[model samples]
Target: MTSLNLLLWIVLGIALQVGLFLGISFWQHWQSYSRLRQGLPEAAEALPAVDVPQKEAAGWSGFRRLKVARRVVEDSSGHICSFYLEAEDRQPLPSFKPGQFLTFRFDAPKADGSGSEQITRCYSLSDAPTPEHYRISIKRVPPAPGGIHPPGRSSNFFHDHIEVGTTLQVRAPSGHFYLEPGSSPIVLIAGGIGITPMLSMLNWCQAHQPGREVWFYYGVRNSRETAFAAHLGAIAAAHPNVHLRLCFSDPLAEDQAGKDFHHHGRVDVNLFRIELPLKPFHYYICGPTPMMETLVTALEDWGVPDSHIHFEAFGPASIKRRNAGAAIAGDAVAAPAGDITVTFAKSGKAAQWSPQSGSLLEFAESQGIAIDSGCRAGGCGTCQTTIRSGEVSYLQSPDCDPEPGSCLMCVCTPRTAVTLEA
Candidate 1:
């Protein structure tokens, strides 16, 4: 045969080998996929875990006893800590929504040395949910330097008193601020301890919707105050779809640029505009009140819809939803202008609900009428009161729902002559 014939034969042999290799690979993949579709146990290891909707934490009003499995300090400042909690009963666990919070009931010591009193506080879940455990990151709120204000009771107690092996009462996770697994790109902005819920949401997004684009903007004062820096960096390094931008307003001189963080200054809507082309991206924000307010307003002014910007607030509901040009502070229903009659049916006290007043709970307190309240942002349902008559408008959506005839007084304002059984 000629030289050209020999070369042609060699090329044919290479083509045959390539075809055979591809055929075998395709067959193996098809077999593995078939096994997975058939729900075969042997193929489970070959694929990612399927994302299933989490079961509801029914009877959430009741508390579950959880034992602290581990407690680790997160940041170099030693003010932030994470606790790993496991079921004391060792029963199977259900996953929770990414942004949900756990209500903790503690028998904390009374400030006046009057023994311990049961107090309830809510803290967001800080990690992805699993059948085995839940994690929460907390920052210790220090007292004022000259003792003008007392230290945070629950936060300090958890840091200084609670430790591994301690059994504590925790209500099942529940909150309206949550993300459903979706293929759409999302932006998450967090500041300080507000990073807890955002962390949970980010982990869920990565695990369940790995292909979705995610932009995480985290801001803190300095490296010392930043938690989960290594973990977040590792995640960004591993996942191409995840873009992490860390901003430190006051980085130490030793902290290197491009190594410790990506940006300098606080997180705001301007950061989004500077870095990315505008898209219909859903924004999840959890941060200090000022940051939350500024971002919400700026994004709205940038023409983002109210439906796209999501955030959660604790304590008083200070963030107002601004849709259209109407500056309605109390939700979709226009609250009656001027003064309205508000009566505490239980206390038999009549008070006027003025437009300048806050929530019904706040107005009640101003009137020296007592009402049991917790998680003043309206998540705990502790201040839900039965509406005897008339209507009320919510300043913001409450995480917890009240009975059909009742309303969460902590977040609602009287829309008309209202009588509340507080």
Candidate 2:
């Protein structure tokens, strides 16, 4: 055949193949649709729309808040707010080993039909376990993209409108920042609102056993923004073993009453190395991103071993731990890699999940399941559930696991088809 005829035949052959594929696909789709229409009865009862009502979070309580009715403006710093909340669950609040944080739920405005509920965030519980309440000092973050705030939410709302008697839904406390109880001669480094968790350790020390030599290096903008100053000062005065050092990035008027409370500039590696006691001690450090980076690097440069250093990032561990490895949560369970279904036993609801969803906790929350949780970072173990039938890829060890049979659904992304008893 001529070249033109061969080209024509080839073109026709390609067209025919494409037409055959399209016809088969269309027929298959029509058959499937017909079967679905016949097998599924006409919508006799419409599905009840998910009703996620808008909720208002009340002020904090438990060891979280002191008995005194102190409003946000009541404290000397004006940044500190104290208030009470009616117990919601009546289940005794979970105890912590000082240095853990409480995750609180806050609803945000969403234009989509999702009813404006947003992610839950955790803040360090600043009070001792005994006070029977959780206390957290928030610095009021601005709206940042890809963070808890797409617009004003959580901390911003807490600072702006949260008032006394406004009950907040709090998760159980969890953290790794607690003192080992004579872990080493203690050295705490804090910047800005980072003082909350460290303060918990300090408070516990003051009441329980007062002899451990403790030193605090707190950095803040100025005296006006410093929180828990008087109370911390009292703890320092009452316990001679406790030494407090304050640094101010911006110190107002020299030789004044408040001037004594301030340090000239930022708290750098030089200052920390010089001010800290000569003896090696357990170091608990927290603060802004830059401060953490600088201090942690400084500690390493000063020959501090990883075993001796402990720190809590201000918010999520995402920012705080840059090179930290993923925390695994469960023992090895053999299962095929595939889609898994999560059944909320209480609500009679189930949601299919994949690794991309991050954790069962996130999936359930997205599905509007009210699983109590704190420190979604896997430290607190509040959003834990039993492995009913299938298995999960728990990123954290089972020992620190919340419940023995259960897994912390936060860091646990499914590696196989799994069903959790929610």
Candidate 3:
């Protein structure tokens, strides 16, 4: 109420404001100093470098070059080499999903003047989950005795050179072909090597969720080429819900396993209908495309919904685009087609495409744009591109965000006038 009291209050308010400002400024300065001390320079934080690999490519570190040995070896149509991979430094290996794969990177001599170490390839994990080291079963391709690509780029590298102490750059297990947690019974249909993923799933289920009925229908050329027959029998014996069915398309007189095999010929619609109950159950199919196509048609004829059928290509990636059904349902927006422009932000190159041209990446490459790509079949996400401000149609559903904003250039088609930061 007095003049002196009002003057004192105003002075106190001014002091409080000044102290607050100084305290806030000191806090920010302390933070900056702490960050600097932690070796996170301002520019480093501003940049988008991550401390870890992308989740989809997680397990590379644990696969340090450790020597692996041939635990089991057999020759049928192809040489199946089962190697016991040891972990270096005795560190615990990362866990992997049943249907996921392991990418092995190695070095080998080339026909050129020098040896190149830049080589990588993927192989499905054949062994079940265990506390010890991982085991992978490989079949040498093309029936080559000493060919480079026979044991395969990665497989041969492992087979020919890698031994008990050979260290390898093993990546974390990453894959999308996972078993959905549902109550439906399962029909696992696989062909030859395609059975690897299904075998993983069956093992996982047997260990964790034991009661789900699973009928495994495996097709091989003959009894000799059938890998893991004994293991499949053991799994079936251990689990009541698990049923094992083997089909040998070409059986020899010596093929005793074929004599008592559940199915004698290839897995066609008639065989599936007769063997499977065809109730509202989930169907997991893998193997070559021809096998998958047969299974899909069989399931369709049995009135199974598309949602209930899940599959992944086990062999090499398909050259064609991913099956996109009739239309994409989420966004009805149409991408402007003709004369679409694509820009590669990193390369600082732009390419133009007309409706007559196939896609932006194809156009860019046709015009001599170099975009590193593998598995052009949309399975490998190596050719990912980021979308800046436009719409596009992709040949397949992407496994990862190519860039923070891009799509896979290998499979993307201009849906709307689109721009890409690849």
Which segments of candidate 3 are over 4 A away from where they belong?
1-71, 74-78, 111-114, 143-151, 237-240, 256-260, 315-371, 374-381, 385-391, 416-422
Model 3 TM-score is: 0.69
Model 1 Cα lDDT, one tens digit per residue, 1-422 = 99999999999999999999999999877775554334233332332544425667553457888999999899999999999999888765667888999888888897678999777788999998888899999899898999999998888999989989999988888887877444445789998888999999888877777766789999898899899989999999999879999999998998887989888888977788888643456788898889888898998887665666788875674876666324332243645679999988889899788978888888999999878777888887778889999889876767777788999988888988988886
Over 320-408, each residue of candidate 2 has an lDDT whose tens digit, in order, gives 22223421213533223566776767677877786556567888888988776655666544567887665566443322345555677
- Where does the lowest 10-residue lDDT sum fall in candidate 3? 45-54
- Candidates arranged by lDDT, highest first: 1, 3, 2
| C-alpha lDDT (0 to 100) for residue 306 of candidate 2 | 54
Clashes counted in candidate 2 amount to 21
Residue runs of model 2 more than 4 Å from their true location after superposition = 1-77, 83-94, 106-115, 143-151, 254-259, 316-422
Q: Write the per-residue lDDT of candidate 3 for residues 1-422, one digit (tens) a residue.
A: 89999999999999999999999999877775564344233322222221222234335533456446445764354467777776666666666766766656666765353766556555667765564677777666553565643434555655666666666665556655656654456788888877877877887777666776788988887777788777888888888778888888887677775344667788776876676652445778788887877677666665565566777774433323133362222322333545866666666776676756665667768877776564443444556666777777754444333555666676567776666665
- TM values, all candidates: 0.83, 0.58, 0.69
Report lDDT (CA) for all predictions: 0.81, 0.62, 0.64
Predicted candidate 2, C-alpha RMSD: 26.1
- lDDT-best of 2 and 3: 3
